[model samples]
Target: MAELIDVLLFAFLLATAFYVLLSRDLLAVVMVAGIYSLLSAGMFLVMDAADVAFTEAAVGAGVSTLLLLIALTATGRWEKPAGHRVVPLLVVLATGATLVYGTLDLPPIGKPDNPPQVHVAPHYLERSGEEIGIPNVVTSVLASYRGFDTLGEVVVVFTAGLGVFLLIGGPRRRRGGEK
Candidate 1:
């Protein structure tokens, strides 16, 4: 039953990812991108990572999509790629090849005995309560170990909002060729 559910979720994520990448219309692309985020959040939920799911649901499914739509309204719906260039394509292919090579060195999925999980998480779960005084390990990890990084993420988001508002929300500027 669990295996079946995992297969279905993976299929959904894959389909939505394809839709996001292959959609012709900008609005459709944006909608599919939002769906991709939602599917990712669902995957996180299934993996027992509630904290990650929460962030993905809020930021990926909600805030980022809204910001993208706002920017789309400010700019235009259609994207012009100018011209297809081989240099960028080659770079992308090289990077992707490197990533695929790196993945070969990773531990296989769902190994009964994974070294990192066995060694690291147990230690955190065991001593976190005594040192951090937090019963919830996830909350402690977020608020302590990566607290500053999280704060910086929020600051970056706020800055982007300010930028979009300044660029799009203000009075229209006179065109250069206006009489």
Candidate 2:
């Protein structure tokens, strides 16, 4: 059953990725990309990284797509063709190779016998509430260790709102009218 779910999820992610790549319509591509994020989040959850999956589901699949859609609306839909440029393709290939190489060093997913995660996490899980005074480990970790990142995210949101307001609420020019 789990295998079937994994296969379906993988199919969804790959299909959406293909749609994003092949679609000429920018809006459709953006929507497909959002679906890809959502599918990826689902995959992460299946792998038991629930916190990371939650973040991916919210920020990647929800907020970022909305922001991208709004920006696309503010700008234009048509993207320029890169038919003449081999550079971008080469860059993507190189980055993908680098990522694949990096992944070779990662601990195998869901290996209960893995030494690294087992060593530190059990202690953190057992004592985090006592140490941090928060019942939710995720909230405690984020509010403590990742406080700066959370603040930065808030600042970014504020800046984006400021930009949108400026774009939509610019001063009106009095042109040949008595007001």
Which one wins on TM-score?
1
Least accurate stretch of 10 residues (summed lDDT) in model 1?
A: 170-179
- What local lDDT does model 1 show for residue 171? 65
Which segments of model 1 are wrong by more than 4 Å?
110-115, 118-120, 146-148, 151-179
Question: Which pairs, if any, clash in model 2?
Answer: none
Model 2: runs farther than 4 Å from truth?
113-119, 145-179
lDDT (Cα atoms) of all candidates against the true structure: 0.83, 0.85
Q: Please provide TM-scores, in order, for all candidate models, with all chains considered together.
A: 0.78, 0.75
lDDT of 2: 0.85
**Model 2 lDDT tens row, 1-179:** 88999999999988998888777788888888988999999988988879999989999999999989998998778776658668988999999999999999888877887885688667667888788888778777677756899899899989988998887666765542656
Local accuracy of candidate 1 as per-residue lDDT tens digits, 1-179: 87788898889889988887666667777877888888888888888888899889898989889979987897788766547778988998999999999999999976867887797678788889998998889888778866898799889989988997897677666664575
* Model 1 clashing residue pairs (backbone): none
The positional error of residue 72 in candidate 2, measured at the CA in angstroms, is 2.3
